[model samples]
Target chain A: MSDFIVGTCLFMCPEKERWMREREGLLHTFEVDEKTKHLKRPKADPSKIVKCFSRPAAGQLMPDTSELRPASVLLSTIRYLFTNVVTRVDYDWVMIYDFVFDRLRAIRQEVVIQRIRGPQSVQILEPIVRFHVYAGQRLCEKNISVFDTKINSQHLLECLKQLLVLYDELEEQSSMCNPNFEENIERLSIGNNRPQMEALYMLLHLGDSSALGRGISLPHKYRGKNVKLAMKISLAWFLKNYVRTLRLIQKLPLLLKFGVLSNLRLLRRDTFQIMSAAYNSKLLTFPGLKLQEILMYRDVEKLSADCKLFNLSFAYENVQFDARKFNKGLLLANPDMYFTVQTLQKYLPIILLQDDDAINDDSSS
Target chain B: MDSYIMQLRRAWLNQDGDVLADLLSLSHNHATNPQLGSDAAMTKAMEHLSAPFDDLVLHHIKVISSLNKDDALTSYAHQSAAIQSLAKILQLQKDENWMLPVMNSMCLDLRRLALKAEASKFGKNQKSGEVLEKCAECLMSCFRVCAADNRNSEDDTKRWGMLALVNQLWKVYFRINKLDLCKPLIRIIESSGLKDQFALAQKITYKFFMGRKAIFDSDYTAADEYLTYAFVRCHKESAKNKRLILTYLVPVKMLLGYMPKKSLLEKYNLLEFWELVEAVKRGNLRSLEEVMNKHEIFFISAGIYLIVEKLKLITYRNLFKKVYLVLNTHQIPVASLLAALEMHGVDDVDMDETECLVANLIYEGKIRGYISHQHKKLVISKQNPFPQLSSLNSN
Candidate 1:
């Protein structure tokens, strides 16, 4: 925590060819700091771009949730999440909060899919995970998932209702940097925080007691002692939703090209701070949350070095190491890969950690 | 009762390590005696030993033993830490820990007896031909011991033995040619209980034939028949075992040069094979290599090799040296080689690389006294492949 220079590479660097030109015919430039390398911020006015940028034709969401009208709302939330949160800030720096929020939004999509359907819903996990997997270039035409069964329409509608409320909270949380944003907006009524919190608690319980739900289990490994897989899953979901919302706002070119807008960076930065505060509250209750903490914690310098090293090992068999170490190192190196690692790391500890404290506590106490 | 077994079978087949570990511990607790428990439970557990599940079972058994001296299984929960401490006590490295014990158990008795007998024969200066015959007999007996263990079904034992031998030969091949190292092995497996005629030997022979022909030219149709028969029987087993089949069956399927039907692949969630191949194509070397090592199925690696070749994901020139190296050392059948080479980067330079590989193989064969180099071509006589060699040279 001292003055340890965290080695890192920012997504924006001077040499990177700016794909889009700004006003005054100037290209967005990333500067190599004395320590950190290649950091570039996206457009300054992300909202202006959001307002102007054209939407894809409505038919494109098909073979997925295209049949549901609420699907468009979720898609809009998705676009908003990317442009507002992810693309707004030059997330090329290893900021802990951005990583948390972005990963949260990605997780939210899974819930959204489930809400749009149900446990018995049409292939929930695949399309949801594939949304990001394809974004990360790890997907191809052959991808398939087993959990794609359809659900009752009523169940789907209920999930969609909850998701819409969650989306409203997310959008408000992400677009807060807009100075025009009032504390109490006339048209938008946010879902009560109590219900949001309650839904989370219920989902966590369902995770523990139910067998058919999202592969959650409370084996003897981490059964008691302190860690709750249910809570961790919920927190992970919340943060992923928040980050995806912010990303949607930032990535939209509508704000950046034309309009006067609030400082998007402030919204991103503040949302992350809020997430960290909430996470810290949970940490007091569950010390074992260190699994996710380690992921959020970054040594920028170490990561930068890891990214380069991992990239090289990609093509050579002589490179010796497991995929996890190489991937962790690569994630560290590339700040832009924050959302990617957070989403992956979210499930791993819950699935893999076999702490004996839970069982031991039962016997001793 | 069958339905109940099916559910337990599902948990086992899922390679649900945690669940299986729990079940194993429960079974051990119910067991009244430790030694009897270990051996008896292992025998009964054959139906539950799918590929990865088998590995987890072995790991759990070791973990249990390391914890309690008197009741490894029953006292599992009590001795988890002590078991971990035992790992340190044994100075067990990750790679060495899981594989070594199983290999040792399978090979130790044979290895020691073989060594002692050879030493005795040499001390009196017995005839060399007599020594060789004695060596062959000893090796055959070793395979039979593996083929006949009462702890598991004969098929499981034989399958276990074939896997052990393949692993052993892979370790040995770097220093010795396959012909020299596995000569006795080839003889034993060819006629031993692992023949296609044997029921338990079905899967073992399928794998044995695949490995045998993997590096040389010969009749693999019979080998394919054995494997296909094994494939039909695979449905009776667990998902973990099905995953195991992909290690070999996938390569065989590819050698047959067609994607397997959806039903077979679905049962195993075997798309990971295609993903690994895609990673290989995209130059994701780490993932590709990890999949090969994790899967530990030579046929899968060979299948990957074929896919890499077919798609031109790799250049033949770059892989020529390694292909040459593998060909020179192993007397795998030509068809197997073509199947293996079919998925690698040998397309544009196919003729040249094939010639180089063939020449290297021929030279090595001549040195091993298995073939003669005449008129700039190799002639096979009294070698491993026998009748298949005449047509192999042209291939």
Candidate 2:
């Protein structure tokens, strides 16, 4: 808090600029805090500008609501597809996912093309987001090791985005119209799984600013215990407090655990990179068991294999961390599962139905 | 009511923005009989004004009459209708900003009435900020017409009005906590060519909000640049405005290693930060937590809680530097640093987590050298190992 410290970054100070110029500081000049700095166009990077701002004008071809398919019919069609395709048979989930995914995409496209923003759009998107998480975990637990299908959780992110847009529009519409606002999810038998969606959002986007904002914006009275825990785990994740992240992930219910499971590669990669520096040595061995435990790998052998994969050395069972030997080329460590094939099979329906006993879980912080 | 119609006709006919602003203002005291909105009276009033503009004038009159009747919901509806007509008229007028004053007034009044209506019992079932959110959409209607009027000559472009609209929209967006929407509008403005040409007041307003947004994005360089512009060039007499700007600027400056003067905080009555500055300098984590909890409402309401939490990294740097200074060696033990943190009340911290902290500091370039795990010590550069955080970004 010294004046010299304050003077060092006093960007607006006339005296500082004059003093720097007098010192002939030509090479390390301060950024010009010109009034027009923001006004000036970005000289090099144009990608920051959104391309969709060039909106189309309304024309006679703009369709009326009467001619389009009702949101109810579209909602039912998606529901039918989900029931018959996704959950009808447990095996071949990988193929069922492709079929259900194609059908769901077309249905959502139909909703967008038809401009559906009623409570029905809410009904349709609520299930679709959950479907992605359930189906994604199912793919992760597949007997085959396909990184491509396992990383297909982007679709869940997309649906979550779609649901956020629908919720905003629905809010505006409810205010625009006085009494008929049915903010209900029960008429069609799909209860508001909004709490589950929030949990998924926190898990999937753990440490993301938008996700963190969603968590912080909610008062404790408004959010459920599940949401509160999800927020805490994500906050720990954000801070790169890997130790706490490891500890908190142990307490999460399985549904929320899928979030940690979703972020496993990132968790492992981050842990290894930091540990390479923290435990950096040519001879000292950071325990392989501790790394396996914190990262939730199935076993230490797999953990050791990943250490080699990331250019770190594994000695016997302990990891020898040399900062120079750490590889920065690979961003993610090898993919690993938190569940065995049998455990995932037993829990697939439970996760899909969101019937994870974790829903009632009130684990202490 | 008769004089109201006369002035409305004159303003609409002559296209006088100032006159129209008063005639449509929410506080303009157009206290007329409620019967003016009845079918027969609306027809009589409509006979005098022209098409399109007639709807605008008539709706404003209806809005005022409803306000007089103490029926805010009805007043808000009529004001919304009035803004809808105003947007059509703004689009209809080609290549002139003579009507911009009215646009500004109507949009501002539209927000006032919306907030008033939201505060009333009629909004009991509505979610907080919904009315204001809808009001932002109404403002967007004007915004689209103005932003899309890019084909006009610079002297006559309605695009000049964009900053004012954007400033209002930013206010509503921040109020409703839908900051995500402000990004596109910011993109349009920053990407637009009319950046410097807006009136000075509007430019100041734009920079002030943009600076706050940058803080949220953690782009401190941009935050410092934009916010310093707003704080310096902001009107000399506007102490309240300067204090508002300082609320954000202080944290950004601190993060960049430029601590604000205590007198400056005292002058602005922002000494809530004085305790924080002291805690950070003394490397007192417990006192830092106490100051934060004592002013928790202030910090959270100002939306700087998370940014303040980020200062903990800086606190750790300061704390470790203290240990290094006392020990006077390049190879200070990690356990010594952990004990220092524990002495300063960093509860539940351990060697591994402390190492994680040290790793983050080095990674962030607060420290020059690296951690030597085999030696159980931090390896220093033997040069300017702990570089001043501010000098790290001067270029």
Candidate 3:
């Protein structure tokens, strides 16, 4: 009996080794063939991968290892399978990624909320936060990805601000329910859990010069000239400064962010560099600055010298800034001030009427 | 005097261009050299120039005005002579057929004079506004004649002439701040089926003037519709005219919550408005004020100062959006909203005034919300806190 067992063990060892090498070969072929095959002729007929996962043989192993693998890991695994295996093999990958990512985010947020504050809070807060995030994602895809820099910046800032507000509300509600909730809530907070996304939000939605200076501290790889140009455009856009926006866009190199090969393709395709080119060629249209003036309407003449300095500081940060130099640059940059001045000159009658309080005060006195 | 009247009648009946031109020149010389003639002699000379001669003299004046060079007479001299002859013709002419042509020629002359006056430092012989008033009177008289003579009113040539005359008259009215005079003309155009008969350019011009008139009158619904119609129908190649239409249409569109495409504005050399659109979209009152001040001349000249100033309400509505974002709740506290308003330069605003402003916005259907005075809060509808300012779908 001992001699037979030794012979069997020796025989099975090579057979097992041969089986292991065959599985490795299969995985390698799967990676290469699956990628090339999917690229060549996409198939939408039900995936064989799905059959493998859904088979009863696979379900037999589930209960035994259920305790070993956490629910979150399993969820992540399923997400990976959907994004990588299922989505990659499918023809409509973009739609699949969008749908799967959106649903996954919602489920993750729901799980987090439920874990932190139970199902009751999920019903109250999940939909609002989900709506904002979904809207923000859609905005990013439609506006930002398409290089609609102006609307993209505005909507991003608004959406991020909304998210921050939701965070505060969640904090307030949880604290109200349990005074000791603060210490326990940190792990469950969406803002805390999604720090990378939060950083992106802060980086994009910066409002002031001070915030801009502080927020733009990304790693070296990401801190490129194209990125800076993008940020500068955003800042000028947020400030409602089209002159500055135009000037910045004009300064952007043709290759901007795309790789050299893609840049060549983009040049041929005329896609990536089209906006700046349009602006340079005077083909882009913008709303009148008069509307901006109305929104920012103030008695600048009434501003004290100190207040002027304060306002200047808000706009620019160079300690050695010369007002005359800046004014000269502004005037030189746009030769059409004549047209702008003429337009304003024509509306002098109505502009005078805008100061109804001053008119009424004079009459009353 | 009977001989002079008979000679003038014979010259007019024969369509004598030279005789009429010489007679106008003589009358103009007499009017200019007041010391040469007594008022009685001038009146006597005018008496010989009867209603029929008025048409003949005006025809001669049109010929003179068209002449590029006259050794002894400057263009201004010719224009003044034309105006003088026009005044005489308008004073004596009673026949509807004669009045219509006289008014048409007068409208053309006055427009030329207004353009000249605008270019010159001093109007010299005539005030542009006064000339514009004369043009308006001529347009009104044309309308009156057309109203009386239905046959002439239906005539395509006469109607086209009237449309062009009224369009020019509207520009004059705008320049002279006599927009109210356009009211009667608008009524006649609409009621008399003139609107249906307008050519494309006439249609664009009519809609533009009516749109502006509506904006001035605070009739935004009508203004939005009319301006959008004008903007859509305006030819793409006529970029300058299109920009002029957009000057008013943009603000109207914004108040109605329809933001114009930035690329569209830039293509038309209207990039100056981009900042304003951004300010209005973001509710940045400070930026709005700054942009307005920077381009004060542009907005004021566009005659959109009042319309843009009214956009402050829309700005306030945008500010409330930030409040909604920050608070992340439908029931926004009055204190927090007031703080937001204060940030936007409403420093002296109290709770009541803030609530009232909110109430006005709500009532205007801009913000779909209600003020809960008892709760010191505004309860915005969950559906759409900021209702879209929907107008006609513009191209």
In order of the candidates, what TM-score does chain B achieve? Answer: 0.33, 0.94, 0.73
**Which digits, one per residue and each the tens of the lDDT, describe model 1 over residues B16-124?**
4344333434233522334523544444445655544444344444444433354322233222222233223223222222222333332332233333343444324
* CAPRI quality level assigned to candidate 3 from its DockQ score: incorrect
lDDT of 3 by residue, B1-395 (tens): 34443555676666563554444453333224433233343355366666545444444434343432321224444455555555454444333233344444445655665455444524143333554565466455655544544453354234444576678878888777667677777777788665676678877888889898887776777897898898888888988888888888888888777888989988888988899989888888888888878987677666666567667778887898888998899989988988987887657566755654675566456677565544677778899777666732231
Candidate with best DockQ: 2
In model 1, where do residues sit more than 4 Å from their true spots? Answer: A1-365, B1-67, B70-182, B192-197, B201-226, B273-395
lDDT of 3 at A220: 39
Indicate the TM-score of model 1.
Answer: 0.22
For model 3, residues A43-62, the per-residue Cα lDDT tens digits are 22212221011113444542
| Residue pairs with clashing backbones, model 2 | none
Q: Can you give the TM-score per candidate against the true fold?
A: 0.22, 0.76, 0.42
Cα deviation of B122 in candidate 1 (Å)?
Answer: 36
Order of candidate numbers by TM-score, starting with the best: 2, 3, 1
Stretch of 10 with least lDDT, candidate 3 chain B? B65-74
